[model samples]
Target chain A: MRFFRQVWVVAAKDLRAEFRTKEAINASFAFALVILLMFSFAFDLPVETTREISGGLLWIVFAFAGTLVLNRSFARELPNDCLDALIAAPISGAALFLGKALANYVLVLAVELVSLPVFSIFNNVSVTAQFWELMLVLALGTWGLTVIGTIFSALTVNIRLREVMLPMLTYPILVPALMGAMQLTSALVAGKPIGADNEAWLKMLIGFDVVYTAVSLVLVETVLVG
Target chain B: MINKILYVLGIAALAILVWNIYTIARLPEETRQGEVFKIIFFHVPMAITAMICAAVSLVASVLFLLTRNFKFDALAVAVTEVGLAFLAGNLITGSIWGREIWGIWWAWDARLTSALVCWLLYAGYLMLRRAIEEPTQRATFAAVFSIFAFIDVPIVIFSIKWWRTQHPQPVFWAGGSFPPDWTTHFLWNMLAMALLGAVMMSVRLRQEEAQRELDSLRRMAHAL
Candidate 1:
């Protein structure tokens, strides 16, 4: 009961803050849309090439947009002694992590909801089938991202070149998620069944999310106290 | 006693490295790669040294997290710094080698790309430590990242193997048997380079500990 209250407090705080400013969501949405547009023009290739590369382009946009949002999410918290206040509160580290990750996951999902159809329009790819699989992959992948990103944001909040450092630190570790997402997206886009290959990627995604979340949960107390 | 022993070992290692370089220089021109093959000695050692340093950093970071001791954190940072230096050497030497051999300065080859990514990740880990204001936070976060970054090392090592299943066998892992002559030199050089990496990491760790002590004293003076 107490833990839920603690989680709700942090979640409510983030929700109220984002509702007032809307800075993070707006930036992420515009940035991702711009990337999709850039890709549409930059390729200049035939539809076949575009179809093949569209999946990769979509993932890239999500990654870049995700990083921007994740960076700002904690950047806002850190500036006004908000993080210190939270630390002083009676919230458990696990609850804090859950709250931050939930907020990020929602923000990322909202960005994706707007970007997905826009991506299909730009690339002329159909998205009727495999919608749920795509959503599943995105949800799993974003959960993994939020888990790692929240931890790193706390880590890099005090760093000098955080914008550059966040992606640099995040992306390489993000390879497994990115690869899993890309593989699943590619398979779905190519009209393949969500069979063994898709299952393999799904397994990898689940494993990554489980392992990273566990590690973050266990280690987050150390990070917060420090 | 330790200093004298290290000095002797260092000199012996340098002599062996010099001799190996000379031998490579004097080797008859290969039909395939010609003079570019000469770069292999430097490139291979740099890669090996980088791997050694990253491995050490991973171990030290894990230890630091488990113990919550500053010494282990210092060691992790020291090894990561050394790892970055060797990775830079690898990239430079590998780029030069590529230009001569492949007629291009850079290709999106699996090995090269993965190595560059690994290097950038560790470099970012260091930057994160520098940016944070608090000591315990810096140590914990940096240690966490070091562990995560080390997970990519094996993937980077095997990337080429996975990508080139149809190509001729890689020299390092061919037919489940080691080529005796090449293995001798490779193992010897790798061992020496690993030792050198350790020596550099130890020196840097000592410096980091001293710096931490200085920081504490400065804080105490401010408090007073």
Candidate 2:
């Protein structure tokens, strides 16, 4: 109970900070929107082709813009020496990590939510029937991204060239999650029936999220302190 | 004494490598693949050797985290660097094989994609090591990242395999009609490559230690 409370407190703190400035959320959403807009020009295909690849394009946008939010998550802690203060606080490192990851999840999911309708409208892909299934994939995929992005964000925050390092470290580890997410999203977007085939990817997404979340929670202390 | 051992090991590796190359060149062509199949002599051994290096590095990373000792960190980096090189070799050889056999420079086969992704993962690992200036912090961060990276490997393999796999099933040891001597030849090549990898690891580990010593000396001088 106490641990959960601590996690919420840490998460709420990040949320409050983000909302006050709105820098990360606004920038991320705009970046995502811009990427979506630009991808239309680059591909400039008929509706069929656009619908075929939009799942991959959406993930690409999420991935690129999500990095912006994750990078800011820890970088913000540096200016005020808030990271050290956070460490000195009574909270456990796991709580701190989970909190940041939770905050990132909410932020990235919000960007995805706003971007999805725009994506559907722009691409002419009707997702009405698959809306709920798409949401399930979106939530799972975003969690996987945040758990990894948040941890790698913390890992690279103190390193030189962190802007470059964060994505480099985060993306390759993200390949499975990204692959699973892209596959499921594309299937749902194509209006394919959800079946055992999709189950494997869902399982992969859940497994990827669980394994990394547990591992990150355990190792966040070593990463932050030692 | 260790240098002497390494010297002998290097000599043995060279002698075995020469013999292996000679034998590989003279070996009979596969009934189906003919000459192009010969690449597997170099390809399979390096692939196996790189996998061993990856396993060793993962163990070293875990050990470093547990012991908080820099030696394991050094071992992890050394093995990963050597492993990366071997993996690169394996990929190149496989590409050459594919170009001739599959008639494409590359295929999106599960094994091929996973290997490429694995290469990128370790490349990222080395890049992470370079970005950190403090020795202990560098090692700690690298080790933690390595553990995470290593854990991702199976999921990578599984995910790709689940998605789609067109890479031909293993015929090397699956009681394929290759003559009995083929196993012997493969084992000898494996031994040669393993020894070469060990020697390279020894040299890299020593370099890492010397570099650490130099770093500490510089820090002390700055302090004074």
User: For all the predictions, what are the DockQ values?
Assistant: 0.47, 0.82
Candidate 2 residue pairs in backbone clash: none
Give the per-residue lDDT digits (tens) of candidate 2, residues A25-97.
Answer: 9999999999999987777788777767867998999999999999999999998799999988988999999
On the 0 to 100 scale, the lDDT of residue B31 in model 1 is 69
Q: lDDT by residue for model 2 over B36-70, one digit each (tens)?
A: 88787788889878888888998999899899888
C-alpha lDDT values of all predictions: 0.79, 0.88
Residue B14's C-alpha lDDT in candidate 1?
76
**Candidate 2: segments with Cα more than 4 A from true spot:** B156-163, B173-178
Query: What are the TM-scores, per candidate, against the unseen true structure?
Result: 0.85, 0.96
Query: What is the DockQ of the complex in model 1?
Result: 0.47
Worst 10 residues of 1 chain B by lDDT: B162-171
Writing each residue's lDDT as its tens digit, candidate 1 over B1-224 gives: 76676677777777777777676577666567778765666777788889888898889888988888999999889989999998998899888877786677888655676788898889878777877777887888889888778867886777666454221234565463434565666666676676777677767877898999999999999999
